[model samples]
Each structure stands twice: as structure tokens, then as C-alpha cells.
Target: MSLPENFNGWEHLQKTYMLEYNRRVDKFFSDVQGNGDLSNVRSSLKLACRLVDGDNEATWSLRTSLFFDVIGYSRKNLSIFYGSNIDTALPVAGHPQLFLYFSQDSQAVPLNGKRLDHEKSCRLTRYACKSGQSLPAVTKANLLDIAHEIKAQFVSGGKGIIYTAGKLSVSYTDPANGFPKGTRWLVNSKSEAIELYGKLCNVIDRPFDINKMNVNTPEKDSTTQVINTTDTILGKQYKQYAYRPVANLRFRYAYVSFGGSASPIFLIDTTFRNTALIA
Candidate 1:
């Protein structure tokens, strides 16, 4: 086939270029809908950007483009489905388009100030995600740090106990913040939320505020006003954990199965999300 005038000369080469971009863009969307960590997606794209620019000197001469949103994964991943016609770096319509837009799927408006999704911030540190400095040698922040890292996101009210028996985090009454109608817990995933709800089932003797909010329906005129913390506005009580912000998190670990038995030491999970030895 003959090349057209606007073909950019290297037709065969251009096809190759677009091919890889197409594959990456497709994979990118798959990960997002899957609700994969935004960081992981970016890491992959940054890797692709490196791989596509391989040893080819001429390819480097090309723009070698991609888009990333500090909020979610790079937009380049989504744009592929629409044929790379994206403006490259501009924000999209309702949300930031070319760039990453921050908004809740439930709400139509874009997140104005600080929108949030669980970034890979789920790293495991020696101490814990909530409590820092369990040990000196283990300094790197891990995934567990995610919960604590985002603690400040919620407004402080009073004192309460956070149930930690299973996967779901125990949310509390944020009467200070419109109870469940206003704000919720800082959970890492829906699984974590489930764990909290499961626990609530057995202990719903009292009208626990946070859990009630999650399970029950908010009043019809429930327009969220301020994101501040309050003291017993709805039903349940209120409490707060002092907030702290952490940039990076660690999720890996080391383990030994046999404590008494003589066995070789072993390196535990790779990414830090999975557990190596459960005793």
C-alpha cells in the first residue's frame, strides 16, 4: 500500500508506534474499572513509556507522549478507546479530561479541593499503618500505613473504639460531620468495609452510628454541608484519631513459620499485600 501525504513518512514505523500505545491504553482502562491502585497503573505506564522509547533514537525524536492524573491513573490509558484524539494534557469535560479529574462516581460534580482514592499508599511499615515506628530497622512506610495516612481526612469529634477484628474497618458516628450522611471511614477497600459491616451485624444491639449509616438509609433531604467533625449530631457518638500524612507506603515483610523447630529463615510477601506465614 502506498503512503498518503499526511502519513508522516514512516508508515510502517508509525503503525508500530500506535500499536503499543493501543495495547497499553486498553490495559489501563481494564485496571481502573477493576479499581486497581492508581499508582500501580502509573508505574506500568511509566514503564511503557520507557520500553516504547527503547534503543530507537528516532522514536525519541517523536513526542513519546502519555498523560497522568495525580488523582487516578494516567488518562492516556482511557483515551486509546477514543482514538488518541485527546488534547494530550487538558482536563476532560465534567472531570479533568486530558489530565486526571477528581470526582465521586455517585456525584456528578468534580471534586473541588481534595478528592481521594486509595493510592498504593497501602504499604507495610515495621510499626503499623496507624501507629508509626514499631521498630527502628523497619522505617519504610507500607500499605498498612494507608488507613493512618488518611486519618486526617476525617474531622475530629471525640473518643471512640475502632474495631479491628476482620477485613472491614469499623466506622464510627461522625455526628460532627453529619454521621454517615456526611463522612465515612478511611478504608482501603470495599473488602475492609465488608469486614466492619459483618462485625456490626453481630453487635447491632445498640444503634452504632457509623455502621448504622453504612447499613441504613440517610434522610431524603440529606444534603452534605460541611466536612467538619461534630460531637453527636445524628445517633452514634463521635471520636477522632490524631491525623498524620505519609507520602510513600511499604507492603512487604519477612517471616519464619517454625518458631521452635529449626528451619531456614524466609523472605515473606513480595508486594506486601499478601501474608507469608499466618500463625
Candidate 2:
């Protein structure tokens, strides 16, 4: 089916995708059951349904591709459908798509003992697709190809938490300009904000103090605002300065798992919103 030219909101779009995905899954299972391969049909059906539910429109195409791929692989590897170990065997035997999905869906713990945060597994799946690598090959390679790249890009050395791209508006108090408000340095990305923060720290003789606070609001509207305040004393005179971040810094981690073991893989990508700096 096709969407209407005036398709209104995301709710409608999501419902359409959900309906189509369910129809495809139901038909696929019915056809499989009719073929007399009734072995572990219930288990297979349950897993197949998971591909659609709880997923968004962005991953719909990839999940559809994975669904058909699983069917094709299962046909070639018939032994996976039978026996007492069918439940376990079917996922890892020759079905990389299923294995990847299970791994990405499960929770993972890093060395810090904190649950990693990030976007849905679809982000990594899309990343893998963009690299032109087959999911089966990535699975067989223990997912290192994607894992290594993700770590290089997102993870901070000695800091277990992942750093996702975010927009930040930092404004510092500048009394010399006769402005009551702080001079703002609007940065587009987290990396750029950090770089600017480092530069600010260098100019002062004493260490710049960093204070972080969580805004008290609804979870969906919650944001982390970091304040950097510095007190510099020159002879008898002292200057107190403060910088505040007005935008939200979303924190999340992505993980890849196989054989029940999960490892942090990547962070969700976010675009930086640009705001004009106030002098």
C-alpha cells in the first residue's frame, strides 16, 4: 500500500507499518505450517512477531529483509527445526538476523556495573547495512568489525559511559561588556562543546569547577544541564563566573550480543541544533 499525500502524523504512519508487518508475518507462518514443518512452529512464530512489534518505522525494512532471510536460511538448514534443542539451535545455527536481534534486544552490563544506554538495535543494524557487510559474516566474525568502530567513535578513554552527539549552549557571565547575561558559546556537537570547555579551563590559574544537575521534569521532557563556574582571585579583587547549558544532552549506549554474552557497541546519532550566541 501507499501513504496518502497528506499523511498527517507519525502515529498514523506507525499504525500502517504495524498492520503490514503483522500481515506479512501471519502469512509467512501460515505458509510454513501448511508445508508440514510443524516442528517448533510456536517458538518460531513468537520470535517472528517480535520483529514487528516494539520496533519503529525506521527499522521496518531491515526487519522485513531479515524475516525473509531467516526463512531462506532455515530452509537450507532443516535440522534446526527438529530435535529438543530446536529453540536454541534455530537462532544461532544459520540465522544471523535472529541472533543479532536477540543480542541487540537483551540488556548488557559493562565493567562499570552500569547498564549501558543507547538507541535501539536498529541503529547498529542500519550501520552494518551501510558498511555493505552481510549480517551473517558480521555474526561469524563475532561482531568485532562493528564493535571496534563504535568504540573508536563513541567511547571515552577511562570513562565507561558512551558520549553521544548532542547540542549545547554555554553562556558565561561577562561583566566587563555591561551585559547582565552571560556571553554564550553555542556549539553544535558534544565534541565541539568539550573542546571549547577545555579552552576555557586553560585561561584560569585555578581549576575550573564543573557542576552537573538534572532538571526536574517529566521523563520525556527531562534534560541534564551542566554548569561550569569559576572563581578567580587577582590580588584583593575576585571574579565569579558561571556558564550554563540550555539544551538537552541525551545519553544512551548500544550493544551487540552473541551466545548470551553482550558487549557495548555504539551510541545513537543525534543532530545538533544551532542557536545564536548572546553577547
* Candidate-wise lDDT, in order: 0.30, 0.34
TM-score of 2: 0.20
- lDDT per residue for candidate 1 within 1-279, as digits (tens), equals 876767665756766866775555444343233323335533454444432434465544332443223323343123122213342421111110011011122232233312222211011112221223343322123322322322222112211122211122324443222122222433434554555433332221123333454432223322222234546758876543213111112222222121122231222322222232221
Candidate 2: 10-residue stretch with minimal lDDT:
270-279
Off by over 4 Å in 2: 1-118, 123-137, 140-142, 161-253, 257-279
Clashing pairs in 2: 117-252, 117-253, 118-252, 118-253
- Which portions of model 1 show Cα errors greater than 4 Å? 1-9, 31-103, 106-221, 224-279
Query: Model 2: per-residue lDDT, tens digit, 1-279?
Result: 987998888778777876876655654444234322325543454354435456765566666666656545223212222113233432122222211111111112222222222221111222232224454234423445443433343334422232232234444332221112323334445455454334333311113323321112222322233223335566454333222223222322323322222322322211101110100
